[model samples]
Structure formats: C-alpha cells, structure tokens
Target chain A: MQSTITGKAYVLGDNIDTDQIIPAQYLTFNPAVPEEYQMFGKFALSSVPASQAGLPKGHVPFHTKDEFVSDYRIIVGGKNFGCGSSREHAPIALDAAGIEAVVAEFYARIFFRNAVNGGYLVPFESVNRLCDRICTGDDVKIDVENNLLHNLTTGEQWQLKPLGEVAPIIDAGGVFPYAKKVGMLKV
Target chain B: MPAMTMTEKILGRHAGRDSVQPGDNIWVDADILMTHDVCGPGTIGVFHQHFGKNAKVWDREKVVIIPDHYIFTADAMANRNVDTLRKFVAEQNIKYFYDVGTPRYKGVCHIALPEEGHTRPGEVLFGTDSHTCTAGAFGEFATGIGNTDAGFVMGTGKLWVKVPPTMRFVFHGNLPPYLMAKDLILAVIGDIGCDGATYKAMEFDGDGVYALNIEERMTLCNMVIEAGGKNGVIAPDQVTLDYVNARNASGKKYDVVTTDQGATFCYERVYDVTKLEPVIAKPHSPDNRAYVSEVRGTKLDRAYIGSCTGGKMTDFRAAAGILKGRSVKIDTFVVPATSEIAAGLKSEKLNGQSLEDVFLSAGAKIGQPSCAACLGGPSDTFGRLNGPISCISTTNRNFPGRMGHKEAKVFLASPLTVAASALTGVIADPRDCLQ
Candidate 1:
C-alpha cells in the first residue's frame, strides 16, 4: 500500500496460470487455518517447471532455479497474466512469495480482482510490450500516486492507469476491510 | 440513449439504473451464488470471519453449495474438504447444499447449476468456479469470481462490478454433421488467440448458433474462459424457454433480455460454420487450434469424453454413435456429467443400444458423474494422465499437466473426435469413422 516502492523484477511470459502459480498438489491444505496458510508461502510457484519433483514436464515461463531468490518484489508478465482458474491462491502464492506488485499488458479479470480484493498484490496494467522492455533482475520503482513505473535499469518509464473504484478497496487493504470502512458490513 | 446489449440490460437492471455503458462501475444484487468443495470451505471461512458465526446469510435460499471437484477421490484431504462443506451447510441451515453420496448430488457445479433450476434466463449468477460463465448460455450475465468475492456475496447478496465491453460472434449458415459446437468455439479461439476476449462479454448469435440445442449451447459457453472471456451468452429462445419452464417449479415467466438492434460492440466477428471443420486445440494451449484432418494420424495413448463441457447426454450420445460396433484401441474413458446424465446413459438407447453398453463394449471405462479426470484427481482416478502419454480429450483445457501428469500432452476435441481417435489409436476426424 506504499505510494512509492522499488524492487527486483522477475519477468514471465503470457498466460501464467493459477496452476503454474500454485499447482493442485499444494492446494490440499485449507487456507482458513493459519498453520496451513503458511504452507502456501513455501510452495508458491513451486510448479513453474513441471519437471520439478511433482510438476509435469512442460516449460514454465518463469524462473525455477532452487537457488533463485523468491523475494522478487516486482513481477512483470505479458498478456492475460494469471489467465486460468479462479483460485485466489494464485495471488496468495504471489503475495506470499513477497511480490509487491505485478506489471502486465493485460490480465484475466478474475485474477485482477482477486489480487486487489485479497490484498495479495497490486496489479498494474502497463503499456504494450512492457514485458520486452523490462528484464529480470532489473530494479523497478513504482510511483503509485503518479501512476508511473520507472525502470531504473533501462532508464525508461511506463504510464499506469488509475484503478478507478478499485483504488479505495486496495487502500483499505482488502474487500473485507473496505466493506467495513464503507459500512457495507451491518455489524 | 444508445442501444444496450443483453449484458448491459441485465447489469443495469440489477444495479437499479436505466442504462449502463461499458467500463461503468456499479454495485448490483446477485440473484444466485454458487460454490463448490474446492473453494467453498475457504469462502465459508471468510464469510464467517466477516459476518460473525451467529450472522445469517443474506438469503439462505439464494445460496447453493455443491461438492464436485474433490469428492469421489480416495485422498483423505479431498474427503475432508467435502466434510467441511457439510458442516458449514448444516450450521448455516442452507437448503441447497448438494452433499456427496446423496441421491440428489449432481456432478460438476456448472452442469448442476442449470439442471437444478438455479440458472434462469436474465438472472445474475455468481460462483467460485471459473466456468460459472457457462450459465450465461441461458441469456444471463453470469461470470466467475474468486473465493473472497464469493464470500462477500454470501454475506451481503451484492457485488461491485465493472460493465465489460462485448464482442459479438455471429455464426452464419448451417453447421455440417461432422462439426459440433465444440468445433466452432475452437475455431473462434484459434482466430482470436487465448487473450483475444479478455474482460469482454462474448455474445454468440446468428442462425448457426441458435439452431444448436441447449446442451450444445452449454458446450459453446463453457470454454469461453479459455479465450479469456468474462462470460459467453446466447439470447434466450423457445428452446431455452422450454428447458427452463420444465425445470422451474414456480411456473414463473422469466424476463428474456436481448441485444438491441445496432447495439455498439467493441469488436465484431462472424464465422460461416458451414465452412468450419472439426477442430482441436493442440497440446499446451487452447488457442493452439487446428483442423482434425491436420492432426489426423497423430498417435494418442488415451481418449476421454467427460466434463461440464462434454459430459452431457448429447455429448455421450455423439461419442456412442461413433464408437458403436467398434472397439477402442487406445485407453478410453467416458463419464456423464450428472447422475441424471448417468441414468440417461443407462436407460437411453442409440439404435437399441444403451450408451453405457456401447462404451463398455468398446472397451471404454465409465466413471461416476464427477469431475473425475478433468481436474486430474488423486492417483487411482479413472483415466488420469500417467507419465508422458498423449491424449485427446473433450475437456476444455490442454494446459500442461492439466490431466494429471506434466509430461502427458492433451488435445482438446469434441466427443466424436475423441471416440474416433480412440478407435484408430490416433487423432482422426469423426467424419472418417462415420458410416
């Protein structure tokens, strides 16, 4: 919820689905329980490369090296990022992995809302070909108030759009807190 | 005032506004809310956390809980998921909880939503499952949301939403016997690619689309999410009215919303389905589409027909028609979407042969009406992808490891194509196998 932020970027390709974010195998534990919820953090994006222990044999567009730092604050992706499944787990996993925000050309509608409403991450819709311009391990700074994303490594900046009504919800930390603040919660 | 699409009309009505334009944000009342075992437990947890344990649901009768995905599996965790739903349903005194092992237990939330009279024309519906958009086939403005959104809906009976721009896909001319609704949708997805319709309402119309039966329409709408559509809809006609009238106990006449003539759209595309051939989405992505003839002779280890998308009685009949008097060379699995469908397969006959008999005689394994292999169940799930085998499935997705194994490749096809491929031990056009 910070107005200004800086982080390392982990770039990914198009259609990075919920399954790839958190595979079905790791979803066995209930998110309702605190102890089980922590399991999500440990296994976030664990199936990026299907060849990993329980994953299938397919190319995952993101980094899968065991030694790679999981704390990439800014994740960049192409069109329709988080395109499959309605699992908030996708955003939960990303947030658990310490992703502060996601910059994508477009996003699946449900995933966009989940990320904002769950207080998992801020989804910033960047200009086209933004993924090509941003490289992995690059230092990126997001100016929330100005709606600008600065690529400090490339010395380029991209404009971000206002989230409209979603901004207040995000500022409230999540849908539940937003509802409480707006008096939507009767109690 | 501008002419409004059905989606705009429905949302506007619910929002208590005269008209709504695309991108307009509004809060609307939800007529029905659905959740399944996979996400239902979490939804319930959030609902209780926000509303308190003693709080009553906004409307008990409007909420539906179905346990479909994790049920029927040997995995203890899967079973526990359903147990959690059962406890929540009991505590809430929910009337529409479809518990596992009950006679009324329908399979696949999408299919069950329509079968149990929950999906009426022009009603806004919401579910935790992504394919909730399938209900939009009944002329409703239904879309999928996450578990947390579903939780909020359960507590307040309302949701804030942005009206999405619509894309109209007009399918003209007569569809060929060799082709199905599945083929038409696949062709559209291929043309538009996976991200083509993101955040857009795909309104399917034209003679070719209206000519299809309710089941075929469901098949067409079920896969809209694959192309990143928020929802897919067909304006209600007599065919839709008849189906709803038969199932609806109240005998009430539901409003049928239609797109005004000359309604503005963000994009418009038309397809002459007569020229369309049987199409399949190749391994890895639903947008990787090609004609069945192009992929013909490609060897496959398995062929499957079942899911909310392809497990309807009509789909089984089509597969049975192709598999009649033939033995499948590859591992073939057939599943009905609901118990009613299962009963129909047992009782209904194709040329005096029951679909169950046709499949069983063709060396096909029949599974109970659950999402058996669609979501890739626990080990021992019938027809689950094991290892690096290639499969042609009627299921919507072909994403890697979707069917169970990461190495296993899946081709998304119609039931007829699947049956034809199972008989030939390779991908083959259904037309080639038809007598």
Candidate 2:
C-alpha cells in the first residue's frame, strides 16, 4: 500500500531492534498485521514510570491492527538500527506501516538488504540535525531519493542518500519482481 | 604494480581471463555457496524470478541450505522463508539440505561446512551469513554475501568480488594457556580498527598460526568480519589437510599450498602473546578488548558456547575439559553449532559420560543445533535480569547491549573462557580454574 500522499516523515528513537519491531510473543499468533505503536510505547516510556511521565496511558496488552495507523514515513534512529535477528518481518512490518523509507544513521547489513528486497524504502542520513532536535512525534518530510530529510514541524532539513545501490530494485517491487523485470528470473 | 595475494591468485584462477588485482572488480565463480534460513527464502524467490523458468540453480551439489535461526524458536515469517527454501530446493534438486538434527549436521555454519568437507583450500567460497569467512581457515578465500547477491550467485554461479590487498598479521611466540586464537583476534581488532581490514583479505602469518590448531584458526578467521574484513585466509599446510582428513574420512587428495615465499602485504601487525592473559571484548563493541582479569566481577545472566565462531569440535573439548568437575552457574545455555558437534561430543563419551551431561552438570540447557541466544537472531529475550546484566559469550560481537536490554552488557570471550565464566557467574580468567 503506497502512502496516501507524498511529502511525509516518520520518526523513531535510537536502538530499534527486530524484537521491538514486532515482539516475539506476537509472532505465533499473527502472521501479517502491523504493530508499530504496540511495542514502542513500552520501550520509549520504559524508564519513565507510568504515573510520573508524559506518555499516553496503556491500551490493550497485545498488538492490534490499529497500531499500524500511519502519520509518519521517515524514521530517525541512532547507530545500529534494525539490529538483532535476520528476521525479514521486521522490515515487512514497517512496510505494512506504510513507511516509504527509513532515515536511520546506520543499519545492520542484513536489515538494510531485507528492507530493499521487501520493497520498503530506507534512505539513511547522517543524524546530525535530527539526532537531538527531532522529538518522537515530530513530522519529518524525507525525500530519500533526493538525499534530504526535512522536519515539517521544526522546519529542519537533513541531507541523506537513498538505499545504496538497491533502491532501484525496491522501486520495482522487491527482489523477485525486480529480477523478473530485469530478466534475471522467469516470471 | 600492487602486489598480489593468495586470495587474488585464487580469484584470478577462477576468473580465468586475466589476473585480478587489489581494488579491481573481478567476477569469479564460487566453488561452494551456502545460505541459511534467514537469507534462503529471499534467494529462492529471486532464483525463480531471475531464471525465467523453474529455478535452475547453477550447481546443486555445491550449494547448501540450513535453517539457522528458526528451529526451537520458530518465527512464523522465518518458517515461511524456510518452507519457501525447502520447496525450491526440492524443485531445483539441490542436494545438501541440512535440516537441524540431521546426522552429519552440527554446530555453527562454518563448523558444519568443514565437518561435511565442503570447504577446501584454493576455493572461492561464499555464504549468505557474515561469518562465512570462517572457511578461510581452510585456506580458501571465503566471504559473506547479501541475499540479493546470493540470489544472483544461486542463479548465475558467479558474483563480483573486489580483490582486496592482503594484510599479513604475524604472530610470534607461544600462546599462554587460556589465551586462544579468540583472544588473539580480539587483540588484533583492538590494534587495527574494526574497519581496518575493510574490503581486504587477512592472512595469519608466522610461526604462531602454524602452532595453533586448525579449530583455533577457524576462531581467528571466523570473526574477521567483525573487524570489517571481507575474508581471512591462512595458507594451507599439512596440519590444515590433517584437520580436513580427520573430519570426514574424505582423503580427497588435498593440494596444500602457501603464499609465495615473499608475498607482499598491505599491512603487518605483530603480537607475542607469550605472556598475554585471557582476553575479553567489552560490551557494545567487539573491538573493545581487554584482559579478562581487568573485567573481573562482571556478572552475567547468560553464557553461550555455540555459533560458527566458537562452535568447533576442539572448542567443545576445551570448554568441557575446563568444566570437568565444575557445575555451571544457573541460567546458562549451551547450544552446539551443529548437531554433529553434539554427536561428536556424545560419541566421545566425554569424561566417561555424555557431553550433554557435562554441560548439564555445569548448569547449561543443551539447546538444539542452531545459532541461538548468540545474536538474538532467534531466541527473543536475554531473560529478566536482577540489576544490570552481563553475558559471557563465545559467539561473535558484543554490539551495544546486544544480548537484550540496552542496560544489559555482553562480554565476548572464548568457549573455554565463557564456560569458566558461566561456572563462576562472573568474568574470570579460565586459567584460574585450569591448574
């Protein structure tokens, strides 16, 4: 599902792992449902006690189809985004969240490839501007193809490079479809 | 002219047109190709899509498929990937399909390959897993490739490789007890920055490499990637072939070779470890190595001794020997890299009993053959911890709190060291309990 409208941004904090991407407990029950906000709430607000913090109150304990609701497409994370496990589902879940691209400073080799092959775009940028300036809910308009990430709320722009050497493949709809079009594989 | 290395020579031989030099993009044929469950599923789809018909893999015999991350802790999506690979392997008639627990299958990826006699000297080996460089211990130029690249290799039997300049690391002097190839490599990683060898090939030189057993060499080459090297190779000698012959009874008439007498190197670092203590890599970064004694009293919630890096047969013996009469601290998990390693230990009737028993007595859960807990590539959690937690692991990497929580810490060490630490429940030099 392509984004409803272009010119959007998604945001995330640092140290995003495959486990928090889709907690292991939900793996058995649901095969293909997005849960973007389901686990992040716990991880982001972990240290901030529920009674004394500025985080939203808890809802259902388990992942639901609603957490996939989108308002963001660009993610600004710290070093080693998508670490832990070679689970392609981590990117698949993000694609299900309608993420046009990720704007992490760096990524694990496997996760970077999985995202491109899954047809989800991830344009990495130097986190210099967005590192401390951008908040969790800040709106970022990242034109990954143009090497730029612009925060709409704060009017800050970050220059970045789209997926290295593999973005064209994602535009063709994952590796299989890309290879099929290139006559590398039989359709 | 930039001097040539063994890897370039081998890749040149495979390239078959002209000599390939460092920094030159050379297309060479792969002698052996492997993909685990994580990368296998994607390659399967690409193989069919790229071939324009039923997927006709370049070579069925040389290719192997193993489900590394999806055994006991099955992720539905990963299992789907496994199913995709299984069905494709059958359709393509791919011969070496190693389901977990199968006979002749055991330990981490590199451990299983050599045990099966798949890796050989002078070969251009490739795997879909990063630590595939472990095969270089057999004196081959082996490296890891991504899924898409593997897909291309699976369909076409060839991939582009940049022939890298060779960096010779000369080790001299006798290795102290409890100081192993793992410690040696960690120290090297410290000396040379993690990216010091990026896109370059590493060859262990001097008397030290020859003195160390082949299993120990695997440990050295296995984590070469963590140092950003594409491959790690050691010239094959009699000892190398001896380890090969010992594995599978495949007296395949090995042609052992060495680097030309005065092969040029891009860089050479030396270490005498004659008096080096047990080494441990601190948390968040594998390159941050320190003496084990320096990191004493670092408590741990887990201890893993499996994975391609430290899952060799001798590694088990080293750990089991050090752990003979001692019991493991509670909450340690011991997973053999492959089932054959378990079988080998079991058949040896270690300590006049089962290898599993020794590990169990040492407070380890005999985990099934798979890369587990090491990377959380499978097992999801590092378990609820008391305060800040630490883990002494024999597997690769101690990436920022890699085990579980960010507050948690991981220490990278050898199988012997990890087992001893698991017994003590804190970071202690294995030599402490040795004599």
**DockQ scores of all models, one per candidate:** 0.60, 0.14
RMSD of each: 2.8, 5.6
In terms of lDDT, the poorest run of 10 residues in model 1 chain B is: B245-254
Q: Give candidate 1 regions above 4 Å deviation.
A: A50-69, A152-158, B249-253
Instruction: Quote the true-contact fraction of every model.
Output: 0.54, 0.07
Clashes of each: 4, 22
lDDT of 1 by residue, B1-435 (tens): 789999999999999998999999888999899998878878887888888888778888889988888667778877888999888888889888788888879988899888888889989999998899999889998899997899899999998888989999999988787888999889999999988989899999999989999999999999899999999999999999888888863454578999999888999998988888899999888999999989899998989999999999889988998998999999899988888899999999988999899999999999988888886767767778867899999998877667877667899999889889999999999998875
